[model samples]
Target: MTRKAPDAQTLSLMLDNVKFDSNGLIAAIAQQHDTGEILMLAWMNHEALEETLQTGRVCYYSRSRQNLWRKGETSGQTQQLIEARLDCDGDAVLLLVDQTGVACHTGRKSCFYRSFTEDGLKEISKPEIDPGQLYARPHKH
Candidate 1:
């Protein structure tokens, strides 16, 4: 469903209801809006959550980098937010997004490229593009 950005007051109310973890971050799951395909899961701090709700772009907290990481900032694989939903407990978020290019650092369409089957863990999907090709330009931190 198409979603209009909520007004600031409404958004603030929504944010106030979120139950962030002790680390001050919440788990956010991004999915392809139309296909409902799970793309990736990431952490979102308060700033990331607010910016995503305001800008309609998915931003995540980079635990490794210790900074805010905008989707597609370096790889050109942006996730444009179509809608954002908080879980019943308000501790998790689901992002319906229009994904551009790929959503995985491994150059796969999604981070969930593996699956467990009767045979055991199996590689369900192959990388569409090479990581080197995706990050051809040097990224300056």
Candidate 2:
């Protein structure tokens, strides 16, 4: 089915049904339209979700960092949001974004590189740039 952009009222109504996780979170999945390629999946708190809609930018709650973060804030591969949708269960979200560059923090175009196979797993994509070179200094081993 062709999903049209939801009106603000519809978006608000949809938000009410979302079931936040134990930590008051929901998973947000980003994807590219032309390719139907999933970019990355991250968590979002109520605040983050609202902010993302308000700003037209994808923002997610970083569990490890314990804060809200705008995707590509550090990497410069920011995703300009195209649309956001809640799944039937409302346990997850799907974001269509106009991606600029790499989407994964690993410097890959997408986070979903490892594909399961009968033999094992295999990488499907290569890094666009070295994370250390594109974002910040690498941690010392």
**Using TM-score as the measure, which candidate wins?**
1
Q: Tens-digit lDDT track for model 1 on 1-141?
A: 556778989989999999999999999999999999999999999999999999998999999999999998888888899989999999999999999999999999999999889999999899999999888874432
Candidates' TM-scores?
0.93, 0.85
Q: Over the stretch 64-133, how does candidate 2's per-residue lDDT look in tens digits?
A: 9999988777767787778888898989999988888888888899999999999899988888889887
> What range of 10 consecutive residues in model 2 has the weakest lDDT sum?
132-141
Model 2 residue 61 CA deviation in Å: 0.6
Over all chains combined, what TM-score does candidate 1 have? 0.93
lDDT, candidate 1, equals: 0.92
